[model samples]
Target: MSGYFVTEGSKCKGRPLTTLPVVINRDLSRIINNNLQLKSSHDLEHLRYIAQQRDEWTKLTARIQEAAEASQSEH
Candidate 1:
């Protein structure tokens, strides 16, 4: 468990810290694809989903930046 963290829950999950970038990339790609398929921004539901995705993207970007800074400082 040296390079892993266990999430607290009934079905405890563990994943390597290094895999975070891959997950973020996958999520961002999915969001971009969804947005690319949008024909119009008039639908309220679609607008809400887009807003949510934006927030997720922002958070992921921050996390990635933080990770990069941490890694840099470790040198």
Candidate 2:
């Protein structure tokens, strides 16, 4: 679900600092897409950090699993 609504032709913030809703409207899709790209970048950074920390990868895996589970619960 997206976070913003639309009015007129210009794109407005969904909630001052939130991305707009895409499913409800297409105007918000552009902003939501930018957010997705940023999130994807962050996810890649997390995975890359995990890969670089092989000395403690076992511990890292446990931490990653916990983080994944916590994020899943958020959904």
Candidate 3:
């Protein structure tokens, strides 16, 4: 029953921010508690793929944020 509750977002223009629950299942919790270690090539490759996806998403998010800021500034 112990997990994380992630609350993200800023209160803009007097709007209330909401909190979202991120539940880590028992298997994942156990794995995390045990200190995850790569045991094979497959695991390493999978980790690399995840890292690449994360990097891509981060870049995309930055671009979107920049566009939004630029649009807002135009007003």
Candidate 4:
């Protein structure tokens, strides 16, 4: 399968080469109707999500930089 990638034991197949997983809360309507005046709950959720993403990216970036430095030293 041209669109499949082997990972460990399972074979994951999918569309093209790019895809992003997204989760849309079903309670969105309820949240919106609750008059979440100052910094709505949804906004808070988005902020928390972005913070988590930033932390994850920072960790991955640090690991990559460390690996690159080590690899260069070995050469």
Please write out the lDDT profile of model 1 over residues 10-63, one tens digit for every residue.
543685344543454444444322332222233334435555898864765565
- What C-alpha lDDT, on a 0 to 100 scale, does residue 53 get in candidate 3? 97
Question: How high is the lDDT of residue 4 in model 3?
Answer: 23
What is candidate 2's lDDT per residue for 1-74, written digit by digit as tens?
Answer: 21122233765567644333322122212332222222344444554665588865576545546655666798
CA lDDT of each candidate? 0.47, 0.43, 0.42, 0.41
**CA shift at 31, candidate 3, in angstroms?**
38
How close is every model to the real structure, measured as TM-score?
0.33, 0.28, 0.32, 0.32
Give the top-scoring candidate (TM-score).
1
Clash number by candidate, in order = 0, 3, 0, 0
Of 1 and 4, the candidate ahead on TM-score is 1
Among these predictions, the greatest lDDT belongs to 1
Better of 1 and 4 by lDDT: 1
Minimal lDDT window, size 10, model 1 = 32-41
True-vs-predicted CA distance for residue 30, candidate 2, Å: 24
